[model samples]
Target: MRRPFEQLPRSLSPLPGEDLHGFVLRLAHRLDLTPIVLLRHTGLIDPHRHSAPARRMFMLEKDELAAFCTTTGMSPQDAQALTFKPHVDSYPPVATALLGLRGLSPAPRGVFPVWLLTTSTRYCPSCLAGDGSAIQQRHGGPWKVVWRLAATFACPEHRSFLHTTCPACGLPAQRIRGRSRSLMVEPHTDPLHPSRCRNVTDPEQGPCGARLDSAHLTDNDNPSDDLLNLQHRLLRARPYGTSSALDSLAGHNRMTDLFVLAALIRATWPLTADLAPSPSLARALDHDIGRPGPAPSLRISATAQKRWDSDVFSARGTAALLAISARILNLPLPELRLELRRVIAAMPPLDDAAWGQTWLNLRRDSSPLFRHEVLQLLDQRFPRPLPTHVALPGFLLIRRRSYSPKAIPQFLPEEWAEIITAPLGHTSGRSPGKTAIRRGLAAHLIQAVTGMSLDDAGTYLGIPPAWMAAWGRFRPLEERLHGCRADLSVLFQRLTDHVADQRAVDYAARRKRFANWTLPESDLQRIVENYPGRRRLLARGSQRGARMRVGFSALVWSQLTGSEWRLAPDLQPLPVEGVAMVDAGVIHQLQGRNPDHQPFYTYLHDLLPDYASTVLEGEDHQ
Candidate 1:
């Protein structure tokens, strides 16, 4: 590690160009190496600033090469490998060459086709140290001088070209640590967190079950410096075990933006705050920021902060920020993992506009959709856009979002408590929205299907019966639904046992209330009673239909040809969703009207895919 990098001769055999500058540039094209790596071994194409137009042309050419590789299914690493051949035999010479331009031979031969990797450093024009000098000067010496090379750029002769010192190590002209790689690589967030392992007891450390990374620091005014190193990173702050989203929202704007990504990992994710926890962060806040932890936790007269829970420092931002926080917070595995998961979940589901830009940026290769579970999620979120729907139900069936409120606790530090208040409610509670009315209607609809008293379904879905009844009358759609009776035993058991098809039975049960199926309390008692083969009723077509069904559903529509069908519980019909639950006595009535129509299938055909209703629990044991 102490050896000069100049001795590291670049092998250009399989690559396309030759000559020092040309070879380094070609090696850059071939190896996709960073300029600092290149400069350590060689030097700049122009020792001085070339015309801006000339530099633009060079950049344009580089951009074109990248585009070509991306369009052809080549990753940055693949491109490097396709053109690189790391030299095992000529290693010493390359190492010497990497020690900087001073150690090279003028009559260099054989080195033309040498194996080489490249990296680059930028220098501050003022004092030749680096643009970081002014920032480093403020932090003083301890963090300023990191690399010996960064110091050399400001050595007397070149001092005038440098600006300020380094922020981390404070040395003039020193390069900050850039990633070291061979051939080519994609600079992704490291994916080696220990939490991903199968250890049963969660680790006491960070989410990855190990120490977290350091957060990168940026000058509030110079956003350009932050973006300068991104080199093809995805914009979406995706978490580990997942790909990223390169959206414009993540673009550098000097905003010091804070985000909280909460994943309901394992059992529950505690509610964490979204501000930096350090006293330094508090010291950094503007006067208007109040308590300086999070905007929501401010102790101003706002009632929300008193009962608030949530940790300070949102879990996202530049790799630098994430790295820094990971290092500083020393978060335990559970907390870190939850934070990572939240980041994953909080990431807006990628849309065509956002994902497309990334695909295009990547040269339109496969469009990053190969991940199976993701492809399915794509279908669920945009059934029409992804061009596939059958796979979606399975995807959504795997992760239902409802968990207890336990996650709220996990978010805040143990010392903090949650402050909850009715967001806009006042003491008088006057002027309510139509939301209440719609909710009432939804309640009334449920009672029709489960044959629950207004009180029963209220208990399940968590609304009171009186409010539910009033809401029902308020919303017209929930007022007119009914279903034929279902034996209560069969409901808690298998729908197929009492009804013809399980899908139809479940569908009927779910919809009875919405359809306004009259369920006298007697229906519940009937199924609760001894098995009655046929407790006769007045009969169909009587003033009060005898064999009345009960259930509420929005699953009926007439096609141009007049065909109709029942919808699966997901509200869409998959072959797995094909079950028939018909009025045991009335199957004969609709026979000729629809051929493939099992009374169950009849309602199902019209079913819409309600992706939120299910999760794949790995095949029903039932």
Candidate 2:
């Protein structure tokens, strides 16, 4: 067991908005001891444990926090303020869950995605030179927690881009390498100033020890006023403020939206070159993101592409990319959609497969509103009719609450047919095989409204998977009814409108009620009593009778519920020939083509409603 920590004789109060790592550095400096020594005394690190500390140390656990607070005599709330946990709701990048870094020991080594900046932070030289207060004069000023975010590019107070790398070492300030876990480069070194560069230049020699606060800015380091304003807007949106200004701009997800837009701007570089604010900013972006040919993947190697992605978060040339991204994000939805369309149209001609892959990637990374707009642009660019055999992409589906699959039938309902035809105008005297087209239309509607896949919708409607696979042969006929894109859109909208306006039936209840239902034996016998031959055909115990019983049950099921007869309970086991015979018999009786069978049809029509009411009664009780 480790010894308990005693209150320190001298400890500095944490500065406002200071980060946990920076506070540790300043506290160690105030007591004239090394950071590692202070951590050991506070029981934060075990000397016997040779392994390096984990990155999670920055976000201390309960017991670890208690020990640190006890030794420093700082309140828990004040210590917690030095960490990033409070800002997670307003700032997205620091949310460890989003970065896939939550609960990780030492964070993995690699080029992380542009959304997170974990390894290092950019700094404003003037801020590090102390605030002229007594405590800051003894130990350097606070290293702000906000500086670690990739979205924070410019220093609003200084009116310039934050410095990317140290002047002497040419490495990022306060960088934590893959194998190293300590926040400071030289954690064991005593008497080093908090604002000096501690990066290890050589193993044998000590750190670079260059004074960071002494670095000066050049003319080019200053950015335009517009870029500064953008930075200010972002700062106002941070959690430190009483109210987020960005909430009014893009709602709750404004930071995430901005990050996604910046990523897209970086990916599609000079293709969006015209959107750049100034000539100097354009050159900076060009240096960071090289000018590629028509397709970015074709010109850039995989390694170089990874580096470019990393640079989007780095201080090197990020201002230009973010400036362009902010402008695009500020546009109204209509103008934003048009601008995106123009950018996509400017790309060099590529095959359909390549374009599809690009769209897939965009859909994967985009926000919901952004994804919807991109899909609309795609629909305009490629007006191919919806395919019947394959699943529709998610973007094409209606909202889930709009319709239910159980409410749709195998054939288009008569009421829906009337609504759809109104928008189609005259058919030019061409039949176009309305029955087959109607069935196809029914399948399409199930998928479009309920968000089911083509196969799932077909199965639900009593269409076999094998039959759907062979639907390609009828594509030509389906195309005739589709007419032009405008007609198709109008027809679909009308159908959707009708569905939304009407009260939905309890089809799920009907399905549950009829799942194991069969017509009573007494009712079946009474209908067949008129003709002895027909009665014998449906007699009990015969193989043919068993099939005929299922068929009769299916016929009655179709009468009670308007669903397809083929989906009737206990009917799937019958052979194809038996099913065909049963179907033909049912059709003959219902059509009243045979005068002799007219009485039997009348009896069935009268009996079904009574049986349906009984089933509904049971459902009500349940």
Candidate 3:
């Protein structure tokens, strides 16, 4: 635990559950906890508060404490093995009071002391490790903590400082992190060690907008500042650098620079004037069929390729070239392309159109850290939309890398508006405010355009993804069977050794595969597969033949849900719910006493005279 939080730059950024630790530390300092403690308490450490050393590290809510001990199967008596004293002498009145100071408020004013533990210098010796926190607000269960760093009282540290690596051409944040790291370095890189790459120029709190000079490089031809270089370096280190071999990711070493590598890549572009992928990038990949990664042979989804082209090479442009050489060391071009594929795969799975539009946003020169010329060029080619999806991952990615959240607006084409209604990822609890807004609006638009019910509109607007996980948890494996029989059959044959023998693979493969199957047979085959047995699977027959069709699979749920339930934006059926109600429309699609039925609100009007105020029109009407 590094003390005087300012000394360590790495301790500043937050880890998943560590935000609480940092908050307490910063708060303690801010509240002048040291003064009262210096006079009254020996140290903040309480010998009686926790039974174990680890338990003492974090602050838990009252209920949480009970749960923790219960979950861990330690009786309160055994748990009493730790200390419980507040050590109020070392903490300020506010700090002490917040932590159950006896004389102040009747109840402890603060939430769990998770912030201080998370920010402890002991864990990381870089920067203060705290999530973005708002000033003390009224206490409620739903408070959100922001994760960006902020400057207090004319931060001198805000100014950019020269470091060994260039932000543009450096290894991913996961690899060689020290402290004071960029907000948007590649994920799975390093937990940022802030000052390690402190800004050379800054007003504090945002992008420094520095211009490139030859001095940024150590040796002009070096590729030591990049991720690929680091990986290769670790490769040379054997068991020491191996995954299980090393205790921590940072224990490994590397010196590649990605920026210069990109420069080399661009210079060799248009390989042989073909306008195809460059040879230098191609040779880097190791896609020899069953290899760890695909070879120089490009097989990443077109959509993924488009996103990649927009993110790294195309969007970042010449500026990105600065970091490429440092990242990729001994690899050839094909391997590098394969590396790009890996990066794309690692990134969250968002739609291609959204990714493209976000890329189009990169062309703007809204900030000096990026190339305005490129943004201009992109604008000329892929004009902005009327209104864009505000909660895009691209925005988050850019903000972190550019070191300025505001830079996102500049990169955004005129079309994209800030999503104020809901946040991007409610599940993670990170994204908040205005994310669901767009989907909600789309539902309305579909209603107007297709004359579909609000429920149907929302369903149409939010269909299950074809192959990957989508927003809703519902799985649509069945529909996929018919639509992609050839692909599925090929995959099954390759895996099952033709054990689930497919006599025919056709559009009606689902029907054909299950043609001769009697009722109550091949349940596993029915699931985990579709058209491979299409002759049998898709063979729709009477109730007796199909054995009383029961629970409609997610494919049917996806279609029916959108067609029926997404009638309005106000209600959204989250991923997991145990019940399904069936009504007349559903009966027409599948002949069964299906459960997903709910009375249309229209009847309530007649049942209750004052229904005008309580019962909505379309809702009550059958």
Candidate 4:
């Protein structure tokens, strides 16, 4: 028979904003018992680890906590709500694993959130160092769940930001007390006391037991109380409601969307700021920057790029970035919403590829919401109006939206005749096949304006030749293709505008992959001598001559060889399209197969058609 556990003589009342895991530890300490002993008594011990010597008091599961609460006469609801459950909606995966949500939910398999949290816990030092009187009265200040948020910079009560890494050892704050049998240190005996750095960096030496409190705070970059209040509200807010439908479509929940928004704001900033025209946002960013002098050129460092690209961010950085995004939305700094309607409204058409590149950078591995938001913004900016003069506007608009061209009312061959040819006063009695006229006009326009074949122009516009054939299917072709008949000036203006827009999109996609690459001095010299414009300096040092980037070099080579080279991968063993792994013996055998004994390049070309002409050093194919 299982022995029945009894309630404690003195059970600690739940403190305000206290996490249940910490509360349980405090309870165990007050009971003069080890966490394992307390858990065993409460019938919550893991059978697998029950007999195992000692273990850290990591987070507890829902069932275990419920059992603990039942045994200790504490309300299970209070225990759960006080723990990490409050933020589960924002960071579902961490909470799901922490709480073992699969055991709680009916259909838990596909319910993971798109974003993740930092792999460490954070806490406010000042909040932990309460007065002794307060400690004796109700234990101590609680570990507020608000501090767990990546966007939470400061503790309103402390007027200082939460600390994560220890100052002494630079190790992350240890939330789960290390020892199972006893408290790690004397100061930490009181659960609410500020954590001391107990990180053991050297086995021979004792822990760097420095107290983690605001008394030793060095930075003065605390956000104002108003900002902190706004952050508090934003962090606590959940993504439940009608707006979540948009989140569902975009494959992101509310919290992940906020992260994407912050990233986009940081990436675009001043350039996109002009589109929204928010004085409040400008003022907030300026205040945070605290630069009285003329704002220096905004050249982002490589370190900053890596930080921005990563999903994780310091609370201070996240808060500042979110503030700017809030300003762009024209919402009060305190007001928060999960939907992107206002944000999309503020976004200007992504006219430049750099803007598109910024969107791509922020939305990488992100939910569909980011891409949908961009497309919707473009649609709002340039609605595909019935082509008044030429198909160029229609094509550009359709291409920008990235929706099916068939969905829109396409221009007919007669419409093209009206725009391309001078106004014929009398209607012609004879009309040719609609498809033929449409194809001829499309071919003529593409060749004349872009100076490329029909196929190449289609590729540039992200449309297939087969897809273009279906365009204007309802109309008939009557006349042979000829030179454009529209006003010369109008044609030139339309062509330039269309081409410029297309180029911006293309450039942005290309630049997104471009990076600073280092090459050997010999390769650098060859590139500079052969293609001066292609060489770009990335870094330079005394011992090593200036290292040049190979992004443009790779792009030039791709164009020359008619074979694509992917620039996204590491430069060391670069990623190519058609290269295959072959043994040295295979190469020897293949070389021997040539009856006339042709060069190795010839045999390699026979194996991979595009490889022989470009990769090998020989007569240029072009």
Candidate 5:
């Protein structure tokens, strides 16, 4: 069992926005003790453990933080603010939920995401030199929490890029190697300055205790204003104020978009060369592009290559990539698609498969707006013969803010068929079967728009998947459609325009309003008197008469709603008897036009507009 911690006789006040690891170092330095001793004394780390705590040291558990507060006389809120917990929502990389963990528990195997700078941090020398306060002068200065984020590259206050490694020893500052058992470098070393380099040069030579805050140690290179601005925007707690394009996105989504865009920019390097904001950036990009491999041997392992691909550690490389990504993200939808196409066109022919992989990754990782743009580009590039897995274009899948599947009937309506078939233009009798093509087109549209499997969409539409599959085997629909791309494009545009302008009919609305409605018996009786020849066939007061009435009612319902006769209410229960009667009635009306019901369809279509208007006007009076 653990013992309660007692208040420390001497301790430094916690600095604002300082990380937990940095606080531990500063407190240890103030008391002339090593970080490991301080941690053990506070009961934050187990004194008996042989290995470094296998979780991120910055993320503390509730009890651990309570113990630290109890021992140091600090408030719980102040101690809690030291961890990345508050920023998790705005910063995705620090979100442990992404790693499938809960609360402040460390990740298994210490395997954090590469996007987080858990093992090392970038630092500005001037910030580490303190603010001339007595306490700061004694302990150097606060090591900030934001410097641990890979997205943060430059120090806005100092107007320079953060140094990645110690200038004296050439090792990443405060890095905890595999052999170490604590967060601090040289954990047991005493009498060492908190701002000095403590990384061991040799087992015999001890630690390289070089001052990190000295003026001579700072890097001479100055950062561009644009880079500094980008860094400032990224570091702001609320990023919505940065730009209009970013204001529309939530904090998490905005950061996600930026990260995804950066990934894409890096994945296709020189192809995105023209997107760089400055010549220096373009030259840096060219240098990386020229030498594809990092080592002199011209070979790179997959892990190393992945690291290089997501290289946020290098200040110049990350700045160049992120600057280009931000510019691209700020583009409007049409230009965004065009820019993606331009980059894709510049890709090497041999890397077609690579581009495909990148697209798949984008599909998984991109924000909704970015995903929509990619989908639009995909629709234009591969307009026809799309894979079953791919989603159809948004225009094809939706209209008037409603799902297309609900609006489309099982069979193509006569007016829609005319619009689609008008473009084929007498293909010398070589055109596919008109009935098969129309039905196939309906099924294909449903499948593509809903992103369902071929079999699933067919089943949903009451068409057998095997039948459509067999038809495609005999004469692939794609081959025929591919030849008429130009005509089809124009035809599609015409259909879009027609649908937009047509206000006389809303089949989906009619279907919903009349889902359970049937023609009144008074109207049916009056209509029966006109058809004396079929009067006995539709006689009332018998089982046969009841089925006949239901069948005819279904016919009227189908006509009014523009749905397939098979989809009318109460038809599913009497599939055999009801359907037979409905079929006979249709044939009687068509008069030997077995497959063409245009005459009857035209009569109903011509009558519907006035009937709908009368019904609505009467309802308004009521």
Candidate 6:
């Protein structure tokens, strides 16, 4: 279907890591020709373009590539190895998302998949300098496809992080030089062609036409050998399998997948905010073996936001994430398991529906251990066949009566010190460390003073209340009761005073309303509309009918009053006994009649207004 190139004047041998575009540019420079002429001679022009070819040189079709290789004295295998096409085809997730097709979709020509890869190029100065050592290598540096990977922060050979932009001019490395006519003012038309350095402030004099390979590594920049080793291992290692069984998470787009999992873990851990080490492990994410790369910048992604996930990581951040993940993965299996369990256990309980929905996406994951750990957590929290019998209501009252003490036990100063200092053996892996023991002890003391049950208090204060119960057995009964009541009387007195003062206010408000008693228009409207049959009785101006006007419905008022108040033909009549003055007791009784309002009376003492004011203020304020 396609033919080879007609002929060529000259061609250079393909360099290692050289992409198709780089190879083409290098060949053209060798022949003293422009990239446009070289591409045209090889039949690589985009058919739809009006001026110069619009398509990038990297977006070469198979036929166009064959023609170019045939003319350049290069092999098809060499071309495939250097290009990004093969790498994109091999990664299924990238292909599916970027290409919008799966399984049988061949990559279409001239369609640049920017989503799958970054357009910004990065290069290693040391490697570039190595390429410049020989006179023949001056045209271009040996650029690797791996250099384009966002995760590949460090250069394996150089042991230093790759540079994306020029430190002097802030111009990004590998930027196309010949995009517009203005950019073409100096030496080239194709922006893909790198020109001399454009930075005027660069101390190195001359036209700034220095090769990118000649860039220098600063003396203070320390290189990481461990990161370099890891990078090489990642490049050489296969995804599906490795010698260590712990390495099974490796798969297609393994680096990206690993970074995603780490982010997911960070999101799911609830207490990570509080338990996070001072300054966060995230701050030091890029510090690989003492060498730090650029600071990580996490940007929110629209797609992830729709799914309610964290912001997407920048390329440098992704590299840091990968570095962090690599360190985590390198830990021994037991240690890793322990750390994971700690994280899961530290999360506060979530509701069934929410937890299930959050975990649903991760359920079908390929990694058995990861899936098992998460599922096992859910299983432990809400096991199958939930308990049917509800706990007894008024548990505190029941406990007080059942365990009424003739004498309660208390601890001595020495024993109290021991309880405060000693560990309460196996506190659900959530035990506070020695550094936080004082805070933890204070929480436990507060719990004990409040009379909280063992399990609830233990979980809250991170101290075993059950253990305290056992310790109390050895103390004297009188001492224990004394300790329990020592700080309670003042609190109880304040609470009683507060309730009495509130009741007095309620009474005063009621008396004022009674003094100005009149059936408001709103109350009349409600009664008339609700009981249309009683309208005639209301309009009759009967003495009994006027008293029927009350805040509550007839049913509730009648139920509260019983034999105290009578009903006329209107259904509810005003009280005859307390005609002149309003009764606050009647209002209270009316409010208490509703089932929803019943709970408010549980803590209040039943006292009349006159007596309540005397008890609250030492004597009546009026």
Task: Tell me the number of clashing residue pairs for each predicted model.
Answer: 154, 0, 172, 12, 0, 8
**Best of the candidates, lDDT:** 2
Between candidates 2 and 4, the TM-score winner: 2
Structural RMSD, model 1:
24.7
Error of 1 at 509 (Å): 11
RMSD of each: 24.7, 11.0, 23.9, 23.2, 11.6, 25.3
lDDT of each: 0.25, 0.59, 0.25, 0.41, 0.58, 0.39
Among all windows of 10 consecutive residues in model 3, the one with the lowest summed lDDT is: 146-155
Worst 10 residues of 2 by lDDT: 292-301
| CA deviation > 4 Å runs, candidate 4 | 1-6, 32-44, 47-62, 89-118, 131-139, 175-194, 204-207, 218-221, 238-256, 265-313, 331-372, 377-622
Give lDDT tens digits, candidate 3, residues 421-463: 1122112221212223333333323332234444444344433
TM-scores of the models, in the given order? 0.19, 0.55, 0.19, 0.42, 0.56, 0.44
lDDT of 2 by residue, 475-554 (tens): 43434445233333334556776776667765545655666777666656665664433443356666655554555677
Candidate 3 Cα misplacement greater than 4 A, ranges:
1-160, 163-622
Model 6 residue 81 distance off true place after TM-score fit, in angstroms: 1.6
Sort by lDDT, best first: 2, 5, 4, 6, 3, 1
Model 1's number of clashes is 154
Give the Å error, residue 133, model 3: 24
Give a tens-digit lDDT track for model 6, residues 63-149: 766775777666777666655555543332233233331112334333332222333456776665545545344665665666654
> How far out, in Å, is residue 99 in model 4?
11
Ranking by TM-score, best first? 5, 2, 6, 4, 3, 1
What clash pairs does model 6 have? Answer: 176-191, 177-191, 178-190, 178-191, 408-477, 409-477, 409-480, 410-480
Per-residue lDDT of model 4, residues 362-391, tens digit only? 232233334455445545655652122221
